[model samples]
Target: MGAAWEPGGAGVLALPSGRLVRGRSLRALPPGPPPQFALYLAARPVAPAQWESRWLRWLDFRLPADPGAVADALREAWQRAATERVEIACAGGLGRTGTALACLAVLDGVPPGEAVAFVRERYARRAVETAGQRRFVRRFGGLATNDPSVAE
Candidate 1:
């Protein structure tokens, strides 16, 4: 896997295992190879035609506001990363997508508070930009608790 930064903070970051995760900008892609799984966290409703495969699921962050939802998505993405390829994307990459990827790094065994830094150092110098995004990373659970809402 390889990573390249793009405009709007949307870029592909290569995992340690050689898989790539794109934040937000991945939605416009055409299906090719199926990763172990794919997750789309959208603030708005997406067309059903836009989604493909049983491994794919659509999540809304606006309603039902379960912050833990990011953990569930991370679990699936990590599983995919271990074997097949995986990708997690959101609107701006730095905001929601970066936050989710940072939490995913925690799920990948990075410490909760340090997860954001890990991603930032490896992916981009400015990965998580918002206070809320940093808080999400700090609250992210390591291997012990998979709680999505784990408050720091």
Candidate 2:
């Protein structure tokens, strides 16, 4: 919670609240100042990098293995984005990273129904690849809030 990303810079996504988070592929990680915190969604254990990071057990082109943990991590990322260089990433970046970014978008006040489209337009054109991933984004607001009324 010590820095902020330049809005519209490189891979950064500017949230509605003016916070920013970068979304990228670990495979082709861009050159830049390292993030203070990152949320990594991957099936295998991710070795820690110099900067802080949290890895969620998630598969490519699919939903997270633990939705609760993902919601928690996304919330952390969203909060950290207020003053830190926050990032969300996965192997391909389009599927898992995009899905996570969509979830974060929802956390930032984007409607769940439009989060996927919002992320695609702002983050990547092909964000949230699979139908299942799309469904996860749609239901993410409920998952984040633990809102039983919102349905799974």
Candidate 3:
């Protein structure tokens, strides 16, 4: 695994591809330069026009995100992480952010069944907080394909 950008900080998970992406609660963002790209998940739209971010209306606390959008967003985030600082954030960060991180892990070649544990072990003990979210990660393998639809 690649080293975290900020060890023991909010949370950072390294993809098998060697891309390091930070995961944090919008409330726990450390003091420092902002990430070049941020993917924000929330019940409501929280990203402002001024931030270089993408907001995915995730709504429920532990429910999975829209499958279609999740695939596209993860693909974008993964590609951006290759050459830029990428961060993923949610309300408290552990649940949604962790879920997203696990999906990214799957996209990076981790088996879907192990993706959740992978994120929790590296990102936070409480990562990927809901049964539904766990199920989402387990089913994420299909989204790992290089189909162009994932980028749309």
Winning candidate number (lDDT): 2
Tens digit per residue, CA lDDT, model 2, 1-152? 34788777778888888888999988876877889999888899788888989989998877788888888899998988898999998997799988988888899899999999998999999989999889988998888988765434
Q: Using TM-score as the measure, name the better of candidate 1 and candidate 3.
A: 3
Model 3 — which ten-residue stretch has the worst lDDT?
1-10
| lDDT for each residue of candidate 1 in 38-116, tens digit (9 for 90 to 100) | 5665655444433331222333322114554555556767666654545565554455566677777766666778877
Ranking of all candidate structures by their lDDT, best first: 2, 3, 1
Clashing pairs in model 2?
none
TM per prediction: 0.67, 0.93, 0.85
* Stretches > 4 Å off in candidate 3: 1-9, 144-152
Query: What local lDDT does model 3 show for residue 94?
Result: 88
**Whole-model lDDT, model 1:** 0.56
How far off is residue 63 in model 1, in Å? Answer: 11
RMSD of 1: 5.5
Candidate achieving higher lDDT, 2 or 3:
2
Error of 2 at 87 (Å): 0.4
Q: State the displacement of the C-alpha of residue 143, model 3, in Å, after optimal TM-score superposition.
A: 3.4
Best by TM-score: 2
Model 1: ten consecutive residues of lowest lDDT:
55-64
